[model samples]
Target: MRRVLALLLLLALPALAADRPPRSGLDYATPGVRAMQADDFANPGMLWVQEGLALWDRPGGMGGTSCASCHGRIEGFAGIAYPRRDPRDPDKLMNLETRIEKCRLDNMGAPPYGYESRELVALTAAVRHQARGRPVAVVEDADAIAAGEKEFRQRRGALDLACAQCHEANAGKKLRDETISEGQTNGFPAYRLRWQGVGSLHRRFQVCNQAVAAEPYPLGSQEYIALEWYLAKRGAGLLVETPAVRQ
Candidate 1:
């Protein structure tokens, strides 16, 4: 009887391990957190939103024209669809944030905001706020989707892990303490307690890449942007809840 019991315990070990969920300090599924998931209109991140609004109207660079001079009232364009193919660059599509930066250079004749800069954060927050209450609707162009899918499946870093392994394959499996989510990006510029700061989806990707020991890409790089395109499309039908989220 003892010998039989030992064998049974050994057999169950793998099953128990497989059932465990990945652990993280973040509590994405808490009821309070879920309730705030789609509340961007009165977001606590509105401080950043205000900063972005100011930047939009402030004159800068040698051209001496503000973003408002060209784009008009930012509020008027709220909830407008994005991730459209760049008319100039057919190979790349422009997200709302990217378009705003491009306008800063082309129309406002100002330098692009640095990634992680207050200006960028404010701008992204502002643009995202405009989409408040609207379902995320990224384009599904074949080329863009294919590129994103390829990145999603590629194994990289010392961990030799692909995003799909955890998010798709082992979702809900415990690594230590917390449940794993689908690695969604519907809530961005989120105030992650872990990060202790606000960040964009691309920044999150960089952190994940580093965690797995992969080479980190520069922020706003074409590769990261392509990945964002893929992720945004994957998160389509979800609402945009920016600046106010906690992960």
Candidate 2:
């Protein structure tokens, strides 16, 4: 019965999308939470932003260099085109965090930040803050985009569900005590009441995978990275809401 319902939902996607285009999860936030995200002064996430800014100028381990020493304070929406396919390695897509880590290991002689680390999260929040209101500008490579779309729509795991079954077909429908969300990615590196700290989009993906009893991919894995690009593309026109507060 459940699988039948999922099939029906899959068939209904075109009508569902046309009838009501997806919305960011922010639309599902409580009034209080929404206001928290709206007001930077009131948002706790700013602490990380500040931390990241401090790190940006501090001398790194090697050659006494800093991010600003090279990048010299990105003056515009520089990172908007991130997670891009590496020119030398077209199959590998590199996001801001990966680039940062590469600089640390190769240039600064520093260790990579562990997943969800305070320093890493803060830095990502700060960099993304530079493009707060700009839309995501990732270039869609054909192969990644196609595989990502397939992954987004395929069924798996104990529940036998696809991402589209909830985030696309039954978005806004009730699921237990919470309303289903479109699961958009514009407001990533967000603060969640459940986590009591900022988290990355990949972390959220892990959480969702656990919920469905599906095996979650490792952080920075090609599969999840492709999905991140796909989801970001889905929110092409929505503002990048870094350090966004969520519940």
Candidate 3:
């Protein structure tokens, strides 16, 4: 009975293709989620941004210097060219989260935050928030982008689903109560009602992979970073939506 009800609910959802015409995951969101994101006061994700700013000013590391001391305000720093080819090691890719970890250990002489750690999420949110309204640029690394594109196209795991299956071909189609999307990353570090918390893009990526019965990669892995880079490129011209709310 429960399974039948669930199936009915999925089918009952309206066929909605591309929720908002102008673009944005916001267009696809439920009314409650859209309203939550519209109001800064009500958006629970703001708490994490607030926490991120706090951590920015707090002193850490063996030498005791805050992130603010080095970079000042974090605004205008996120431009969506992340998962860049690492300067020290061209083979390695660095996303906002991984870059933060690197800075903590190398520049600040501080311990790196654990993956998906509160501190890491806060910092990443704060950084992305700075980039709000900025356009995502094309990646310079040809090889990496090519590799990511290949991954995006290939079917994987038990479901044999590719990232493009829904995001590219079936985007805007109804999936149960929600609509499939072009899979933009502009609104990352977003507040998800399901999570009841702010989560990184990689976190959401993991969820998608699991949903498809694919073996998900570890957070911050090269695979994820590559995928993020490609996704960012695909989402070029979209505004960053850090701390945005999602259903």
Better of 1 and 2 by lDDT: 2
What is the Cα-based lDDT of residue 206 in candidate 2? 87
lDDT, candidate 3, at 181: 73
Q: In model 1, where do residues sit more than 4 Å from their true spots?
A: 1-27, 31-44, 61-63
- List the pairs of residues colliding in candidate 2: none
Q: Could you tell me the lDDT of residue 55 within candidate 2?
A: 87
Global local distance difference test of model 3: 0.83
Which of candidates 1 and 2 is the stronger one according to TM-score? 2
Least well predicted 10-residue stretch by lDDT in candidate 1 = 18-27
Query: Positional deviation of 131 in candidate 1, in angstroms?
Result: 0.9
Q: Which candidate is the best by TM-score?
A: 2
Candidate 1 per-residue lDDT, tens place, 74-152, comes to 8876667666778888977676667777877876678988777778878777877787667776766878777877888
Candidate 2 RMSD to the correct structure? 3.4
Clashes of each: 10, 0, 1
lDDT of all predictions, in order shown?
Answer: 0.72, 0.81, 0.83
